[model samples]
Target: MEFSNTREFARSMDKEDPLATYKDEFIFPEVNNKKVIYFTGNSLGLQPKSAKKYVDEVMDDWANLAVEGHFYAEKPWWDYHERFSEKLAKVVGAKPPEITVMNTLTVNLHLLMVSFYRPDAKRYKIICEEKAFPSDQYMIASQVKFHGFNPEDAVVEVKKRAGENHFRTEDILKKIEEIGDECALVLFGGVNYYSGQVLDMETITRAGHEIGAKVGWDLAHAVGNIELKLHEWNVDFAAWCSYKYMNSGPGNASGCFINEKYHELKEIPRFEGWWGHSKERRFLMEPEFQPEPDAHAWQISNAPILALAPYLASLDMFEKVGMPALIEKRNKIVAYLEFVLHQIDEEVESDFEIITPSNQNERGTQLSVFLHGEGKELFNYLMKNGVIIDWREPNVIRLAPAPFYCSYEDMYEFGQILKRGILKI
Candidate 1:
């Protein structure tokens, strides 16, 4: 397809888009009295118009029925979280019994580690990517320290080659083999938050298992943005925030995946509570803790109905638009965005380097551009002119054109705005 930098070309592309009507489903932010071209769905998704109704239902239930709403509301507050399992299982490629919605992202990771990260003195080290998201860095370090191990000795970071912005899979696998006997856990972000690089999870998980290590993924940036087969990948466990690409509101409930094999394990180490107990006898208030034979066994408390409401609303959208449709548009829009960036770079005589992987399979919706010979002023210029984007340090901007709402014309408009800004400023 020959690409053009014209509105007509963009419009023609949008007209042919099967997901074009999805843009109307979201409520966008306005800048200078017009809707801003949003590019931060990788950070926080735009709210679905249906989110209000979901929240309102819960609010009305609480207001009218009070405590009785727990078992009597339209959706039934007690079973609200269960509604997410079937739909979310489809989203992440897991069985309904293998999935659950529970605490926030990092908190879920902490809870899951309680069961998976049991390390002996000889096999005590955890392997993760270098410069992982700071929250993960903190979580792993704190967990290591809690286990009486110095993070310096117990945490192995797989580093990228010098002068390279992205990590090579060979480097990652080699690191695992190098730490073979000492590696106790292998956890990495499925999609790197900074680079938008999709790590090879299935291969990495296989390597980790062969070395007698537990493997998991932090899918915060990957869950809704990329295709995942957690159960088939044989991932022992995984967790993700719903707010990013899931459009479940800010800091909403997170989803979890626990392979079904662990559910029947009688000797597994888990942090259990009444909510994780067998539902048949959970309300009996007995002294014994009989765990649910699935992912819900990891839950420490009951569901947060208020927070989970918006998530269920977004999951409804996912059910309507399956991952196949989402990924199709994701590849198209991201490539079109790259084309526009290169075309603009040529016109402006600017050296723009995209650090995100160019291979479709290795990258998601984000393109992290290093604006050589440009500065934060260009980023500011873009923000003040109705283009919403994320700015990282050292003059890099993350442009994540989420497939559900962002249009091709938005990309063209952004290019024009960028050209004017570059020429003027």
Candidate 2:
């Protein structure tokens, strides 16, 4: 794995990669007819070559079968949502019945919150990370406001020490203990979008339950990129968007999960719709809602077959590769990227830091680079040079070398581009 320089090492790794063939499965972006180094999968993944064909099937059903597509199409659009569950369950480590393809990520979060975030006067506070994704923050604030409470008083945000860039597990555990008695819920991103820090879900779940608080996860960045054990970890509920690592296209259908323990808990209130009704009685046009005995109970409307098709295709690919194998390969490639970045000399190192955790277990496929000066300028230079990493506001750039499409050569080329970009800054 040693490289004479970034270039030599990247070339050598690309030659030996067992998954090297996968790079060709995607349609790489071309600017002026040259393929760019694409490291922005954390933002939006490149399209799979087969995605159009996969989507075309659904389009065919819609065009030819129309409303009858619900039951008569080749894939039977009636059960199209079901087609994606098994494969997605494999990726997220959930039982098939415990998962469902449903609303978009933020919408699913709000739905789960409506069922889980029941705040009483004595335990009305919610605990979350300080820099949670904006959608999550907004959802929590709105939920608290809906419950007739001010977010300033009802939401307790956990933060790292002022000088520290990453969250420490000890600090998170301590904060949970400090607020446990008053907290009604603990919802956090499995892997933070900005810092790329992967929280210890098992430990956090246990701590929240011990304090009698419900716990959930926003897994938009974690799914497909990291291994999950939602059932074993006793996560009450979780939701994720599939547009990023899942390669399901922009603003695609999302998935939801509920722990099996909740299936029989009739006392827990839920937001109900006809889609969540038990299939046997759903056609009966019954007025009272009898939910499908598992996670599908959260669905609010009929499945979007076209949107679900892309997710099904993406999940099929994940099922073929298996999460453990994908993660193992991702670790090596990301580590290689880190090795190159660290070699960029003392001056460059002084100007930036890798805010993502150093331990492979503490992150997914992303590395969040924090720049000390001229952040936008550096980002613009890299983009203009055809190195497509994404820039977050203020001072950071997120580069994710996804296992499905990115190669070691892309990482090496990025290193060269980054070095040249910084010199101009």
Q: Report the number of the highest-lDDT candidate.
A: 1
List candidate 2 segments past 4 Å from native. 346-350
TM-score of each: 0.99, 0.97
The digit string of per-residue lDDT tens for model 1 on 346-394 reads 9999899999999999999999999888899999999999999999987
Local accuracy by lDDT, each model: 0.93, 0.86
Q: Cα deviation of 389 in candidate 1 (Å)?
A: 0.4
User: Which residue pairs collide, candidate 1?
Assistant: none
Q: Name the Cα RMSD for model 2.
A: 1.5
What is the alpha-carbon lDDT for the whole of candidate 2?
Answer: 0.86
Q: Whole-model lDDT, candidate 1?
A: 0.93
Model 1 spans with C-alpha error above 4 angstroms: none
Which model scores highest in TM-score?
A: 1
